[model samples]
Target: MRIRAKQLAFAATAAVALLAVSLPASADVSGRAVKIGVMYPLTGKGATWGKHAQIGIRLAVEEVNAAGGIGGVPIKLVEYDYQAKESEGITIINKLATRDNVLAVLGPCFSSVCEVIFPLLERLQTPVISYCSAKPGLSKLSDWAFRNSLTSDKQLAPVVSRWAKDYSIKKVVIIHDLEDAVSKAEGSKVLPMLFKREGIEVLDILTFRTEDTDYSAQITKIKSLNPDGVGLGSCYQNAAGIIKEARRQGLSQPFVGGACTGAPALIELGGKATEGTYVSTAAWMDDPADAIQAFVGKIKARNGNKAFPYSAPRGYDSLLITANCMNDNGITNEKGDLASDREKIKKCWANVKNYPGVSGSTTMNEVGDGAGGNRVLKVVDGKYVDISG
Candidate 1:
């Protein structure tokens, strides 16, 4: 009887251990909501990009949740508005990392803000993916940082070549925003280098502050140079203003700009002046791909049938990619798994190859920037037409 009792106790212990081993696998799938951080400039100069990004991210989260979310655990986005200020951005990132305890962050959408915040990712042990911060080589600042948008240099090269060839541009005058990091890099560095490579002489380089509404002085200088074309290293608002000012001053030379100037707002603001302007962009909204058309339809439905910037699609793609990493890596989203889950997601993002996003086929290059082909778009009659083909 004693021996039989000993055997019964041993069998009960074995059964309990087996149940414990199996419970965790099921528990992980049924864990608490997964948390993701969304940081964007909702109110200041970068509001347009941020607002559109919010739409995209919201749509993505909705779809993911409706489809049962990450392993049946709903995703909760911890959102914050950085207001396009560098100081605000720093504070928000710190809060997200230390207090909110989100798994990954989506954006803080200005290149300048990104420049300051990316270096902190490694220390925080968090991964950041920017939707549209296109300063060249900013991702190289931290292994934890990645960009879904193309760098200014990568985006400008092909478009510059196309613009130079089509317009027979021999000499160019560059105008850039002095206060904006991406604009400064695009105007003072990327554009000049691209123009030289295309054998187009850079006659002069002019500058303007981000807040400067009047560009008469710069336009006056550009008119004096009489270059075959004008190169712009400015965002949509400033670029539109400069183009309009140039037209007002009777300078009709064609204008070409990098990624920052490619938003639909430029065409809306510049009106007739924006016609014939060439710009580089990561996504072409008019693409006839079935997936792209569906995305546009959804966006239009949500946005009162208005056209959206490249940032929208890029934002949508960022969320999907983050979700994919979580799903594929068996991320538990449990409090105990937060650190490991963050590292796993970071490693997964680092190896993303040919992710067929709504924007394009995105692959993370060695420097942590997305490598997808860019489009050289020409403004015609009030809309961007893909002329890269």
Candidate 2:
């Protein structure tokens, strides 16, 4: 009987030892493994931009994983191609939240899509860090939908007005793609106000659809108004198309625009036709930061002589933010728990301060909004040249 009792006690002790080895430290609870849902336009019209955003995101994930996998447990990135549709984006978000049970989500690109999906995410209490959506109404839509990109107001409006005054522009015309929500919002909300504030007459405000590449009609309309300058608030493709058509129609007169104007596509697609066009963008390749320069080199090398666009920096910065958030929160795989970990991550993200990102110093505002400042670049000699602001 004594020997039998001794054997049973030994077995119990061994079981306890095994359990201790298996369980992680109590302090490591917040370092649990997590799955992040990344929704982007991996295919379709927004695919090129979305692909760039995804590359940065994955690069961030790779760097984090290399540094010992957020908290020791690996972070699984589950991606969904929303194809640039709001309804599809919402569906993907729902799947990420409910079926896949992701801790967080990345993007749906367009502001209009973000506006639509934000309500659903708010209801689910799912945290989303959108990459590029910058509509004014986004912050008000929900606490859950956070944006790292700058609002068009802060980045575009001030630049446009300042440039107008500096150049002594007496007349201006704001032409945009009416089908695009972001462009429409920028034109309608800021056109009248900016014209009034700058004391510049808006000779005409014109709209065109994304499908209509032929801008002869729009250019004819704009020429009739005879504006000194034009403000193009649209995507890189559409903006390039408009500029090419405008130049063809001999309507060139100190044309300047926001971020999209300084894209690689403008120069690549429009070639010599894009020269002399100026754009206010959040990124410049000539930045003093070695990191940014190195990244540009890397991307250019990868693309085999293709010029890096302004959007690349935004893409890279978005990943940097995510990786930093994971590091700050002590995210790990050993704990293998996500629900509680996500909550901790959200809190950690709130405290992220002065993080050196590719774009600039990244620190979220009270409402979780951030955007790098704007620097104007002119297409001179078939390349983007920094214009003194």
State which candidate has the highest lDDT.
1
Q: Model 2 residue 88 lDDT? A: 93
What lDDT does each candidate get? 0.84, 0.66
Which parts of model 1 have CA positions greater than 4 angstroms off? 1-31
Sequence-dependent TM-score of model 2? 0.85
**What's the distance in Å from true for residue 249, model 2?**
1.3
Tens digits of lDDT, candidate 1, 1-389: 11111111112112223222322332355456788999987887757788899998888888777656776677899999998889998999999999998999999778999999998987999999999999998999999999999999999998999999999999999999998889999999999999999998999999999889999999999999899999999989999999999999998899998777888888888899999999988988788877788888988898889887888989988887787677666777777888999998888788887776788888888978889998999998889888998
Least lDDT summed over 10 consecutive residues: which range in candidate 2? 1-10
TM-score of each: 0.92, 0.85
Clashing residue pairs in candidate 1 are: none
Residues 1-389, candidate 2: write the lDDT tens digits. 11111111112112223222322322242434557888887776545667767766676565545545544555678998898777898788899988887777888777768878888865676778877766666766777777777777666766666667656788988887676667777776755566678788887788888677788998888888888888877777788888888889887676676543456777777877777776666666688666766666756655665665544556656554554454444444233456555665566555545555665655667777774576766778988876655
